[model samples]
Target: MRQIQAIALVLILGGLGYALWVLYSQPPLQLSAGQADHVSTQTAPLAPVKAATDVTLSAINTLPAPTTTADAPDLTPVSRLPEVNDEETYIPPISPSVAAPAYHGDLSDHQAYLVHQSAQITQLKQDYIAAVDKKVARLESLLEKGIRHQLPAEQLQEARDKIQGLRAMQAQLRHELAQ
Candidate 1:
């Protein structure tokens, strides 16, 4: 019995030792100098290079100039073009008699109404967010205490329904304001 137990312990220790040795004896990953330089250069911002401006041109002798034809027509005089007097022109000026539609009363009243509605909607959104936060906190607390399994199916469904209703209300308010 003692010999069997000793052999079993030695086998287990040997297996563990072999596993640790294998894990530690892995080859050290190495990068070549060129590869290392490439990686480093890729990570670094590129510096702008100045372009070479000293251009060389081929050496050549002066060529003969092209000849012009004698049959070409002469250019016309500028003063011969048609002209118009300033008094003969008819340019219309803008008149203040053309009145623009007033929106001071109607626009201001509608804007004030929308502002009041928006304030109420904002308050509702805040309330919804608070309710959501409270629900999330309760869910998290239940999860942490491992009491999620104790929650009734109907209670869970009710919570989901409430969340959906709040989201729908928020969407409707946003759509109304957009219009």
Candidate 2:
């Protein structure tokens, strides 16, 4: 019965696909007469080209030439220019007093602050490790309870995997703490 139904479904789908292909595969139909006329009337005619003649050439040549009189600046080559003296555009060095403020902080106090921040970071790592240990313990307990209660094997396996991952994370954190 299922085979008969499947064969009929395939035939129906094949007919539908063939119909769609026939509908879309052909070139578009010709436009209506009014649309054709509108398209033809909308096209613009090309402009005529101008012919070049001796008169046009002469007009182009008759433009005024540029003047080279005293009003124009000299165009000396760069290699021929004179060297500039340092004194002519001198910038004085900044005074030591003005630049020394940035280096004035106490290094020992900054060292102590950095040491305190390192202690805080270490404490946070330890706290995270403790949390992970708690999670591992809870997951282990759940796994044991699930086994005793005859829970689904998949659920028991998932609990086991989660506990293993949490223990691995704790081990990594402990290693980092040792560093």
Candidate 1 segments exceeding 4 Å error: 1-149
- Candidate 2 local lDDT, 63-125, one digit each (tens): 657776776788898999977666543465586653212333457798766776777778778
Q: Which residue pairs show collisions in model 1?
A: none
Against the hidden true structure, what lDDT does model 1 obtain?
A: 0.65
lDDT of 1 by residue, 83-107 (tens): 6557634356676774433334455
- The candidate scoring highest on TM-score is 2
TM-scores of all predicted structures: 0.24, 0.34
Q: Each model's C-alpha lDDT? A: 0.65, 0.77
Query: Candidate 2: where are CA atoms >4 Å away?
Result: 1-114
TM-score of the candidate numbered 2? Answer: 0.34
Error of 1 at 105 (Å): 13
